[model samples]
Target: MSDCDDRALIEAAQKDPLAFGALYERYVDRIYNYIFHRVGNVYDAEDLTSRTFFRALSHLADYQDQGYPFSAWLYRIAHNLVANWHRDRSRRPVIALDEIVARSLSEQHPEVVTEARATMRLLREIIRTLDPVRQELLVLKFAEGLSNAEIGKILGRSEGAIKSLYHRTLLQLREEMEKRERGER
Candidate 1:
């Protein structure tokens, strides 16, 4: 895990407010990106990301180290919040990395703008077509770099089960990609 063990940070934060800032600094971008990718918009993503952290902060005292790691717990919270948002809004949202990359490209470097835009568009379409669970798995595994065991912890399954599911999900994604390519051809 990252050296910013949330458990330790939370513990310290209970005593010192400054410690919580460190935690926020460490996780804010990730939480934002995660939500943005899932919801496909800036407003909802920002709201959900803030709510996730707020809930975490409010429930910090209830947190315990189950040896599963802290990110899992935070992700679980974020996932539940997003699910609730979906339920309440009665909408299935899709977050496109293309939007994010485009914003960055516009702000910083214009040279690679074309390449980044194309890649992000393809990536966003592929991600949008994935089953919701597969999309979450990819976010956790590839984007967050969490292990299968950690994914299981976040997802409430066993490590073996998570590994099996990930394999199956990858196969499904490959088949879908191939089918899309064939159709394009």
Candidate 2:
């Protein structure tokens, strides 16, 4: 949608709370998918998505058009919530590998799930080590499953620049993971 289109929608929504439904409908799925990828769980993703929209709806009148897409505003909200979620999650005590294996021994089919979860957790750790821009690009591209053009638009970068950054980010992540595997931090 064009900036004009979003401006109209925003104005309408500002006038009537019911009109906000249109904006919500337009962006909910994308927001949900973005949150899901960040949190890696349906329950928290759904909750955080709801919170993101709730904050957006309440602050509708305060929103100013800074020449950015409406979706960008929603994404900022989602990103903040996700960051908070990660911060909160980090404070919880972590289970040791032995404890996890002991617990998994009781499950009938834990092998695949355990392995997949381990891989994703390791990948998340590696991603967290990246610079903020690269992390955002990875999440927008892989987590939200957006195209390079879409990511470029959201990030305010040229498509060619996004492609170059993505390539470099992937190379760095591969090198980091390999080093990690070789008992190097």
Candidate 3:
């Protein structure tokens, strides 16, 4: 959606529930995927996505345009909520095993599926160790498929900074994987 359309929806968001509904429909899937990638759990991601929208609607009066896109504001809200979740949690890694898919895939190609799942788990564990900014960057860039400029706006950074961070993050992940492969971790 264009900035013009977002502005209209945002203005009506405070007064018209239907307008807010439109905004929710536009962003819910992206927001949910973002949360899902960060939290790595379907249920928590669902709950957090619900909370993010609920909080947005609850605080509609507080949102000002400030020349930023409506999505930037939503992303800030989501980022803050996810940060708070990380802070408040007791710190356990919870993995969502898609059992139905895994089961069927295993039946078809047991070894390949098992190796892929193991690699996925390893990668997730490595990602979970990174700082929150890098983690959010990855989620926003890949999961949301946001452009660097867009991510910069949501992250309050310059596009160059986002690019630099992205480069470093990739290198860090690659190094970690290499170490693991060499049995050095």
Name the best candidate (by TM-score): 3
> After superposing candidate 1, which stretches have Cα over 4 Å from the reference?
1-5, 99-123
lDDT of 3: 0.85
RMSD of each: 4.0, 5.7, 2.2
lDDT of 2 at 4: 85
Per-prediction backbone clash count: 1, 0, 0
Candidates' C-alpha lDDT = 0.78, 0.80, 0.85
Model 2 segments beyond 4 Å from truth? 91-125, 128-132, 145-163, 180-185
Residue lDDT tens for model 3, 1-185: 89998888888877776678999999999999888877778889999999999999988988888988889988898888887888799574354645644776776577888887777777777887888899889989988999999999999999999999999999999999888879897
Better of 1 and 3 by TM-score: 3
The 10-residue segment with the lowest total lDDT in model 1: 1-10
In Å, residue 38's CA in model 1 sits off its true spot by 1.1
What TM value does model 3 have?
A: 0.90
Q: Model 2 over residues 1-185: C-alpha lDDT tens digits?
A: 57787899999999998899989988999898777756656788789999999999999999998866788889888888877887888732121233444465556467766775676566677876777678879879875787888787777898999999999999999998899878798
Q: How would you encode candidate 1's per-residue C-alpha lDDT over 17-134 as one tens digit per residue?
A: 6677777887888777777767878999989999999898888778777776677777888999888887898766766566557777896667689877865666567767777787
Q: C-alpha displacement of 94 in model 3, angstroms?
A: 3.6
